[model samples]
Target chain A: MAEIRKATGFIDWLDQRLAVNKFIKVMMTEYWIPKNINFLWAMGVVLMVLFMVLIVSGIFLLMYYKPDIKLAFDSVNYTIMQEVEYGWLWRHIHGVSASVIFLVIYIHMFTGIYYGSYKKGREIIWLTGMALFGMFSAEAFSGYMLPWGQMSYWAAQVITNLFGGIPFIGESLVVWIRGDFLVADATLTRFFMLHVLLLPLVILLLIAVHFYSLRVPHVNNQESEEFDFEDEAKKYLTGQKVESKVVPFWPVFLSKDFFVVGVALTIFFYLVCFHYDFAMDPINFEPANNMKTPAHIYPEWYFLWSYEVLRGFFFDIGGVAAMDIGLAAFGFANVIFMLLPFLDRNTDHVAPAHKRPLFFVWFWLLLIDMIVLTVYGKLPPTGNNAWVGFGATITFLVLFILLPIITKMEANCKCNTGGCK
Target chain B: MRELKILAVVIFFTAVVYWGVEPFAHSQMHPHVAPADFAFKDLGVNSKKGDAAKGAETFMSAGCIGCHGVSSQGMAAPMDHASASASFGVVPPDLSTAGAIYDKNFLAALIKDPTKALKVEHKFNESRPHPMIAFFGLGGDIDQEIADIVAYLQSIAPVTPMSDKQVFADACQRCHDIKYDKLMSTTDKEALKAYMGTVPPDLSMMIRSKGTEYLTTFINNPQKQLVGTSMPRVGLSEKAQNQVIAYMEKVGDSKKAEREDLGYKLIGYMVLFTLLAYAWKVKIWREVH
Candidate 1:
């Protein structure tokens, strides 16, 4: 508490008023990250970079983009692309970043899962991160409708229609959400407001909470190694680096974060320029037309997995509608992410998935099933493709449903260093 | 180095997923649609070498200029665009680029029976006649008369290397519009909807929506791409078809060349940054472990 003598002039004045030095020291310089962590740990900074990119590029696009049904299409296609100088570059960056950010998020989440990073004291961090994921998804879905293209229109229509699967308030809830009978002018304006204003503001708040929640538990290491953060950080700070198994957040750890971010931006810029078609669906190029529906309608690539789950239930049981069952499954798939901390029954051992055989199999199957569902989702859900999608959907359910059973058995197993009682 | 290996594995898995979801699914969804009768064998029409001079005379004597116009010859249709479209579902196109754009064999079939050539014969019968009156003859052989009219059109057509925009204007403007380019269909919108049973889509993003290959097959025969569609087959020649696609790319994807160029430069910047970052990171981490 008595470490620093009062500084002279403006420095002492500002420090006394704002406590800025103490805040920086508590948040940054004294923060401890495990030395066993890999470059995957840097995804937080990468996401921040992507968020800034989206916010800045989105502001530029909002300048010329029109939200009206009549003018929305042309304002983007003609006015933004043609009339505005270098608007395409901003759009390419925005489009490509919007797409790639999801990939980074999945990797980040999986990394957390693999190392048992959400276990014990780190539940808040995981919960906040998942909340951020949900917010970003909503932001993306809302932003998609602002373009008012064919895919944009139909995707909104299909998503909003999901509300109709509810038993009592289904149809009326949908009408209230859309503000119209069909996906029309009202839908566009409301989604524009969400994309440009409300959702982003919520996401920004969630990002701050997610980052702050990590300060207590600290970042998990690759081996699930636990140590006193104060001791390791003090050792590193006093220049006894070899004895410490952690690095200070400011200078050493950020060096790795910066390098990882550099690599990520390289990959991102490459896609923005050379391979942008990955995000830009050709079907979306045509303006929204209620009269002419596209031959095939599908959601964006990132949402394809759950979209497949929603499309998988083809048969109804007794009197209930099959669509309602599929809708429930879709909701389960998304909500399961938030329940990871509670789902696993093993409270004693916090170890990497690879150290637990059954959980290892579960993790890999979940990843593979997600990829399969995504690919099959893009294909028309008919004939053999329907069967594959069903199998993938069932596999995803089974994997999550098995998490409790597998972790319980691991908890009761004979004594061992990993995944044992 | 160990962390880099983990990254490599992740990159490898990502590449596999990308291939499966994108290029692989795209190929499965839109298989290549083959061209419809490239040789025009099903048409069953034979012709002779026509004299351009005789064709020019027949163009007038046969009263071809009554409804259709040859803008190259300073011939305009008798009616204005509005009245012509109202009366005949679409305004008769100027035949200036017809010969250059439309295949010669297709042209001859179109003149003989306009309905059969456009493959909209399904919509037409004895009671509902095609808008274009069939060419009977000028008190002479019917095939020879058609050949003469075709020759006159070919002679009037501009030579090779016409701009892509001109080719599309000459061929598609009668029924379609590109709002982005500020170009509208010459025919009335309601008339076009009545004629085709659906309003034609704007061509501004056609190149992106339907790629070069898809557009080629679609323009060659609409039925092959979208079965039971009211859109008639347009008989643009292979060269002219390519030109129309090029023009679409120009308007729809105007920033393509610039985007590609800037992408490479930015990637180079990224490479330089990565190298510098690698060195600095290595220097900083040397203090630990």
Candidate 2:
């Protein structure tokens, strides 16, 4: 750290004992980031802010939330909405934020994929990110059950019963997960614990690791240039360098982060205030009745793509259940995303997506396939939907599996040299 | 100066989020309210009180007796279950308890078009041949006809309050076995199996297995809900159907009313907290920026 003027008052007194100044300088004030990172890079910061919002709002909700199966829906619907001052707003914000956070994460993941942010040394960061995504999904699902509404109860039943498709131990595992024979009061209580405490802690830990790994590699910019962080740190500590191709974390990037957050908040609050129920399923307003299943039970929009993949396998393969196969396929889709860092064998350090025509085609195809699957997933499993889901699933697998081969083929082709024509 | 500008923007946005956006969001979330015209008075022909004597006349003229017999003792149709199943893919249910089985709205709708009404209203997806064509196909005061028919059905069998056990025994026990609760004596399971081509599901948790709405609708017209099922339509009156539902509620979801009633208040509190939180966020961030 550079030597500077002595602190005059409270900060100085605290800094001597706690090293608060040094910590701030190292982590925030003097922390160097790539200058060329665009608005996509701002998503991580936005996600962090949203996570805090969700947590604080969630804590407030928990104050009056009843974890009992019979009373959970009532507490959320009646006491919280009517008795508690400002409770409806908190619940709506919490509910709406869950969806908005997923949206932000989707864009963040897409930005990562588009820029090859998972390449080489950033594999651990990418892996941690995927882990966080999984945790987020689990957290959202469990929190969804806390409402004990029609969708909440049935979605819980359907998802938990999915474990039964695992063959042996499936049934037992499902019972263990629910902490009961069925999704009753016990299931709600356990899910409440996981949603409020356990999953959030895991997510927090994974996030810390994600950021730590991210810092080492620095931010991957559009140019994708490499820099030696050790050398930069040495120059700064020795007081030899005044400036470089990097920007300080405080005034410049922090302001940019704040500005982006402002814009995001404006949009977020607009939805919360005007169209809060836009994403909500109206059937969910009805209290949980285990007997009557809703006509259509769809997951939150974020999980629709995977849910479609799961539902695509409508026919049984041999003696195995078709649902089991679909579940395996869904797992495979997530695994493929986690494996992207290893799958892309292109040795080029900074091959922008636009420059790689074949990969670009595959990327957009996969994106479109996901969107189509999501739409299909929302529809009842009719004959046309089954066929569309099957086709989309096939296209999804082919795109993922063929990417490496296509990348290899592009490497060998002389089309870029104007010789093939 | 830069920080102040950022803070000002944050504060402005925060205000917009709370003041400009919240009311609209609340409106969307809780849009439902009782209509201004809602009153104790009858609003239409459908709601008008019907005379049972007139209704009995309408029921016969509407060709209801062609399929449905007044008494539970015998079939009104010439063909029994075996032959009827072969022709319609399932024998139509007896309407002995029709007054106590189907919802009034459902009965009225079914008389119009058994196939189309079921599919449109209840999302019934079974693809069976429509045996009962629309009686109101002649298109002369169909609502009045339905109202009269319903009134006649109600007059014959007003919904008497029955114990959960009596409701299960009288209605569901013939086909279903209450596995958990021994409420009904075991029936001729084999004969029923031969007739329906499948054993009737137990009623021990039938209330839990099928939702209340589905049960009421299905009881009114089995073919409408499950097109080819052996179960025949049991045209119980609306009052009797409601009593059956109440019995089912007693068995399964006794806490439903209480649970649903609590939701409105819970939603109200959530709206208030959102505003305060927004204010707090702005206040805190003002110093940070």
Evaluated on the second chain alone, the candidates' TM-scores are: 0.91, 0.46
Model 2 stretches with alpha carbons more than 4 Å out = A1-7, A228-244, A318-320, A410-421, B1-289
* Best DockQ among the predictions, by candidate number: 1
lDDT of 2 by residue, B1-289 (tens): 6446634743553344333223433343334333211111221225656667887778777776665556643437555645554554434555555555555655665676675544432323346345666676335576776777777776776356555455555556545664434454234555556545666654433454455656666766565456666565544455555666666555444434443454444434444544554455455434433
Model 1 CA deviation exceeding 4 Å by range: A1-13, A418-421, B35-47, B159-161
Judge candidate 2 at residue B191 and give its lDDT: 57
In candidate 1, residue A71 scores what lDDT?
92
How well docked is model 1, in DockQ terms? Answer: 0.74
Full-model lDDT, candidate 1: 0.86
Clashes of 1: 0
RMSD of each: 2.3, 12.6
